[model samples]
Every structure is written in structure tokens, then in C-alpha cells.
Target: GGIITQTPKFLIGQEGQKLTLKCQQNFNHDTMYWYRQDSGKGLRLIYYSITENDLQKGDLSEGYDASREKKSSFSLTVTSAQKNEMAVFLCASSIMGFNYAEQFFGPGTRLTVL
Candidate 1:
């Protein structure tokens, strides 16, 4: 069995400020991802790393940056927090292979911008 842990259950930031969130997993999966979930909107991919030191931009990567420092950890930084925008950031991991895989999510990190 494996477990994923996300730091900072909640994040409070000012508009235009950069904020960061971190995620770690013990499963040793090959792929890790960061996703944003807004109110009434489905999850949108922010960034994903296929392997250590490899970064892949996602649909919402414009305002974010991600890093895979090692096989078991992935981190994300918000380039700038948008005014009046709030969302939950979720971290996920899956095995790398030809078959379909389900992503396991972290509890989530809620962000509130002032």
C-alpha cells in the first residue's frame, strides 16, 4: 500500500503573489500530475511530470510551474494568484504503461485569494 501527502491544507494569498504547494507519494509511480478545480468547473490539468527532472505543460500551465525533483515528489508554484479566483489544487499519480490507469488524488489544497 502507498500514500500521498500534500502540504498546506489551505493557502491564503494576495493577488499577484506567487504561492507554492508540495506533494509527496510513497507509491513510486512513474507519472505525477497537478490539477486545479474551480467552483462549478471540472478539474483542469496544470502540469505533469513523466519522470524525474521531466516537465510537461498541461492545459492550465500558463500560470503555474511544476517540478519533479525526485521520483517520489512533485511540487507546484502559482506564478501569480488571480484576483477573485479561488480553487482547489489536487495532486495525482499513476503508473506509466500502455494500459489505462486511474489517478489517485490527494486531499487537496484550497486556495483563497485576497
Candidate 2:
């Protein structure tokens, strides 16, 4: 069995501030992803990395930057938080070589911008 961990389960930030989140996994998976879920909305991809030192921007990546520094860790930075915005950021991972593979998710980090 393996485990994935995300730091700071809750975050409160001011508008226009840059907030960062971190994720780590021990599953040895090659693909990692970050997604945002707004209230009553489905998950939207923010960024994904196929391997170490590689990065891919997703549909909702416009306001974020992501990094995969090593095989077991990925991190995301919110470029600028918006006022009154609230969302949950989720980190996921899956085995390599299959695009449609099932992903395992973290507990999620909830963000609230005041």
C-alpha cells in the first residue's frame, strides 16, 4: 500500500496574494495532477506532470504554476487569488502508460480568499 499527503488542509488568503500547495506520494506513479473544484462545479484540471522535471498546463492552468521536482512530489502555486473565491484543490496520481487510468486523490486543500 502507498500514501499521498497534502499539506495545510485549509487555507485562508487575501485577494491578490499568491498561495502555494504541496503534494507528495509514495506510490511511485509517473503522473501527477492538480485540479480545482468550485462550489457546485465539477473538477477542472489545473496542471499535470508526466514525469520529473516535466510540466503540462491544463485547461484551467491560466492562473497557476506547477512543478514536479522529483518523481514523488508535485507542487502548485496560485498566481493570484481572487476576492470572494473559494475552491478545493485536489492532487492526484496514477500509473504511467495509460491516459485513462484511474487516479487516486488526496484529502484536498480548501481555499478561501477574503
Candidate 3:
């Protein structure tokens, strides 16, 4: 019984600033993912990692950077934030090798760019 943790429940950023969000899981899941949720849209994948130091770009990977520092931690950085941008960044983890794996989500980090 492990838990997922995300840092900084809320974030305020300036336009064009570089911001970073972090996620950590004690579940020892094989796969971790980062997703962006806008005001009304569906969750869009930003990045995923299957193993330590393995990074894969997702649909919204541009203008962002992701790193899987170790099996228990992952980080996402907004290379350049857009003005007036607002979104919630979510981090999830799952056991990819299992057929009935369930993804566990973090509380999410809300970003507001001025």
C-alpha cells in the first residue's frame, strides 16, 4: 500500500518563465505518466517513462521537459510558459507489466501564469 505524492498544490508563474513540477510514488510502479488537464478538455499526455532514466515524449511534449530521475521520482518542466495560461498538471503511476494494472493519480498541481 503505497501512495503518490505531488509537490506544490498550487503554482503561480510569470509569462515565459520556466517552472518545474515534481511527483514521487512509493508504489514502485513500472510506469509513470504526466498529463495536462485544461479547464474543460480531456487529459492530454505530456510525457511517460517506463523505467528509470527512460523518457518518452507524448502528444504535448513540445515546450516541456521531463526526466525520470529514478524509479520512485519523476519531474516535469515547462520550458516556456505562455501568458495567461492555466492548467492542472497530473502525475500517475501504474504497473505496466500487469494486465489489470490500475493507475494511481496524484492530487495535481494547478498552474496559473500571469
> Poorest 10 consecutive residues of model 2 by lDDT?
96-105
Error of 2 at 107 (Å): 0.4
lDDT of model 1 at residue 88?
96
For all predicted structures, in order, the TM-scores are 0.95, 0.96, 0.95
For model 3, the local distance difference test gives 0.94
Clashing pairs in 3: none
Off by over 4 Å in 3: 97-100
Better of 1 and 3 by lDDT: 3
- Count: clashes, candidate 1: 0
Candidate 3: tens digits of C-alpha lDDT, residues 6-44: 988999999999999999999989899999999889899
For model 2, what is the alpha-carbon lDDT of residue 98? 80
Clashes of each: 0, 0, 0
lDDT of 1: 0.91
lDDT of 1 by residue, 1-114 (tens): 898899899999999999999999998899999999998899999999889999999999998988898999999999999987789999999988235888888999999999
